[model samples]
Target: MAEKAIAALTEAQASEELARLAHELARADQAYHGDDAPVLSDAEYDRLKRRNAEIEARFPALRRDDSPSDRVGAAPSEGFAKVRHAIRMMSLSNAFSDEELQDFDKGVRRYLGLGADEPLSYTAEPKIDGLSLSLRYENGRLVQAATRGDGAVGENVTANALMIDDIPDRIDGAPDLLEVRGEVYMSHADFEALNLRQAEKSARTFANPRNAAAGSLRQLDPEVTRGRPLKYFAYSWGALSARLADTQMAAIERLSKLGFRTNPLTKVVEDVDAMLRHYAEIEAQRATLGYDIDGVVYKVNAIDLQDRLGFRSTTPRWAIAHKFPAELAWTWLDGIDVQVGRTGALSPVARLRPVTVGGVVVSNATLHNEDYIAGRDAKGEPIRDGKDIRVGDFVQVYRAGDVIPKIADVDLERRPKDAQPFEFPHLCPQCGSDAIREPGDSVRRCSDGLICPAQAVERLKHFVSRAAFDIDGLGAKQVEQFYADGWIAEPADIFTLEERFGSGMQQLKNREGWGEKSAENLFRSIRERRRIPLGRLIFALGIRHVGEQASLLLARTYGTWEAFETAMVDAALMEGPAWDAILAIDGVGRVLAQSLVATMNQDAERAVIDRLVALLEIEEAEAPYVADSPVANKTIVFTGTLERMTRAEAKARAEALGAKVSGSVSSKTDIVVAGPGAGSKEKKARDLGLTVLDEDAWLDLVGR
Candidate 1:
């Protein structure tokens, strides 16, 4: 059996395939973007995404709501606070071949209505393989820093960002408010040195410079980030108060003048051929650049042209990334092992014989799920010609953008005679809990919640993780040791460590690895975190589907621990006004709301919450508001078309000014901005006696 061709697939078949693709891509996005770990090779992910796109193109109405085409990245990780980007950060479409690059050029020309004879300039630069960071400067002073998490919201790393010397603290001639977007990366030399230090301490070393740079920047303690050798390269801008320049090249130059490190290899190319040549040059110099780069990015040079081209749901139409080819190597499949995560999801990892992929040693790859090992997709569609992989088989490994390689294809002819099909476990390997898969979810999970030691230990580690309590000198290793010794079993036990262990039969200072000073410091750190913010506490609880953004949103919605707790308890019934209120949140859906309510109602979990609450002072969530803006705290609706800016731009501007932009016109809407072709929403606003203004009047009211 083979995959059905996009052109030959029926509408029902396409819909099912789209659903399958959405689920797989969502998991991949979370692993890569949220966890900073990629599960699938870039090539495999790209191929599936491309297939989904082609299917939707052929059957236009079969697209799913959670389609990969509409998503940029995963939600922000729970380890840090969340930052809502003023302007949504977008991903770029990719081109892997010369033909794709040519097609991209033609597509841009067609979108802008420019003829081939008309000259069009594009800027080409190396695509750095590192974390995307947005640095905001207000009144020449660096104010905030964020990672590109899910495009709309990101992790706040301002404190960690300040430690990087490449980021200037102040600029004398910068705009009143400017947001410079760039990459935060570690050089190869620095990465090697850092790994050597880790190895000396018997700690885990990073697989690549990208992972090291990302992990370092996301450290809970700013001092740890400060100790790492990290650098920044500014390449773009967002939410600028004033225009930096008219062209992309000039804008890069302006950023460089503002004390930002701009890439020296950036060049202006006149046509597709020039773009290709520049990309070739960059690829030729890739190895000697002293940093990692996987591709070259090409963007329309003229600001007006880029604006005219606008954006797709998740990517820009005016720019594309020319990626390097993926690397492949053959190796024997040694074994398959299952690892349990904090949420009790049992994920499988494939152990491979020693092999080198893309200049890195590879010994393991992701098995994804049982369905993947059985040579069928989620929709039961045949893959790899329905060839099931087994131990002792010769497997092809490939690396695209992932730090870990993935099994691409298997050589059936080379399969060992003693090879047998691998059987997935029906019970948790760590605790013997029943392992079950839920409807619509592909991964199998343990039935035992916190009772299992594996889950409990992982949850404890998460509780003390950088984004959570962030206790000094208390890391994953320490948490595991404490758990193994029965010193701490739950979140509440962590607070009682000093009281329970000090002057007891087994004193902490008398422990093999601990001394008086270290014990005292750890106790002091625990004491310092006795007063925790509401958002961090919520995230620390390790509730399913409740990440940093969701936790903050819940905190902001309720403001206090008491209010949040009471609301969750009331919403447990799942059919009242309380439940409706939870659903009313912009980002919270039925699944997330249900998870929060159920966790609150569970007796065991409630006891844990009560114990933690008794020992800690939870701060109320502060309202994120711009006090000086006239539209602050107001609800606004935009209708019809605007000549001055795109709808997304208007929404972003409104959000930046502290106004809430709503899609529907309701009585609660304080203002409505109407333009040409004003529709029923504008009429409804007028009927409701709401303030309705034209686009120009609305712009003037906001002082734009």
Candidate 2:
């Protein structure tokens, strides 16, 4: 509502908007300045201010007395001594495009009485997304430190600042009184580590680096502040008795020499094009960089030029902070719903008021688990600053790398009065089973086994999925429809569809969307898959921890269904060679072995499997790898054509045994398998001192 353009508003509409903006901005000011925890993202606050300015420009009389246009930010929070800065630490105007940057340059020229042809210089530095602080040094010793609250007055944090290792305690060749201004921030690695520690202690986890830094810095206990990993980057100074240098870049260099950390990306550029190019380069490296940066800040390089093109009411005329397009968006959370998985874990999803984020329309976001919804940890400790999301709360949703949706923060002030807490059900919604969460596990599971509709449906879907049976005419919608209409209940029932309904009085062809042709085609596809390979049959069973690789291992270990069943029966006795052999497969663990055996021993499950087996042909499994094979698990370079099998057959055979076949030979190549007419690859293999084997030798080793 706040981001709507001014040109789209009527006079009456503008008046209402002004009132709303005044109230929201005032609340945001209180949260940001007083709490040290901002409810709104900076981009969102900026957009609201921009909208207010635009509305006032279009309808001047509609502006209220409490308009946010006249204010810089909310007043300083209580508890710390207030320091009045000698020079006000002001914010910067924003430039989102190259044209805005070009306009900025043009405006500088007009103010300096210079023409477009003038060779003006500028300096660009990364605008670190962090808390702004000013450190005061007197008589070459650290004295005071304060935050940039409301631009003029700030809270003194000398004790907290003293704990930061990056701040110099004393300097020898310095001014009588020097005030160094910079950002105090936490790096990405530190933030992740902090979150892990928070999880262990059942404390609240921070949303991002900026929040972590701010929260750490504002702690009443200096001991808590001392424990946090904090760093500083000195960019611009506040008040200095002795001048460092004439130009911006030179001043930064001097600061570096004085043992202050400076951003290495800062550089002096000749024109606007260079500034844009630098911004692009920084944006490209944003994700890989250890710390967070909102944008690039550009300033007139020369001190004289900056003085000449001096202050606007709240910002400098000669500089601008070019912000990145927002990855985070504010939208109303509409409702919370639950989805039961094949593993019977009930996952909650937040249905949101549809909003476009980074070009994608996102309407649903994950709530993670019940603990996330209740603002607690595994032990029911508070988290996310103790903010529990209600249905009507306006929440900040961000996309990491523009793909994953995460709820960043909640605006508690905007939450409706009637909103209630989401009740994470103790009983399974899909089945009347007792939903149990074992100690130390995050997910709640249904104990009803195959009786649960959702779990059974999902298992059936997985059974016919592409990696399993992969019937041609079967898809998600068809499977869902068949499950709902009682046409299929288990994997075995699929084969009986034609015998039960084909050319009968109560026929499937009489259905609305499915006709004779479609039904016949579907039955034909089902018939084609009656003879499935061993690996596919094992995976289609959907036993816990039994994935494609584990299934392959089981299939290859026992050649036939009868042999596999007998081995599993014997393994269930708890002491046998059959269990040892199952565990001996390279990738198979005790958990998977137990799961497979337990699944096969269940009376109902075994009955289903027997019925399915009776209706189809189950092929014998083949073992491709043996311990005595010469090339077992070796990486081989296949160079030239073979006199016997084709190159494809050779590659397939090698891959089946866990051997990696490469097109080129390197130091890591164990051996080179060469054919009659060898090429440069064989030469390179010999040059690298790798063993070369002839086709006949390879064939003899594999018993071909």
Per-residue lDDT of candidate 1, residues 481-564 (tens digit): 889989889988889887877733246677888887888888888989999999999989988656565677678768899999
Candidate 1 weakest ten by summed lDDT:
1-10
Q: What lDDT does the true structure give each of the candidates?
A: 0.83, 0.76
Candidate 2, which segments miss by more than 4 Å at Cα? 1-5, 8-12, 56-69, 328-332, 335-704
- Among the numbered candidates, top lDDT falls to 1
- Model 2 Cα lDDT, one tens digit per residue, 1-704: 22233454555445545644654565566556656555455655666666677777787645443457545554565567788887888878777668878988988886666799988999999999888989999998999988888777888889999899999889777778888899999999998899899999999887677778888987778899998999999998888898878898898888888889999999999999899999999999988889999889999999877755656435777789888876778999999888776767777778999876643456777675787788765445566677888899899986522223557689988889999988888888898789987665556778887888888888888788654787867766778888998888888989888788764414567777777677777788898899988888988887765655456656865778888889899898646777765654434555456667888888988898888889888888875555667777577777777767656556656764557566556666787999867888898888989989998888786668
> How does each model score on TM-score?
0.73, 0.48
Native-referenced Cα lDDT, model 2:
0.76
Clashing pairs in 1: 79-467
Tell me, what's the RMSD of every candidate? 7.0, 27.9
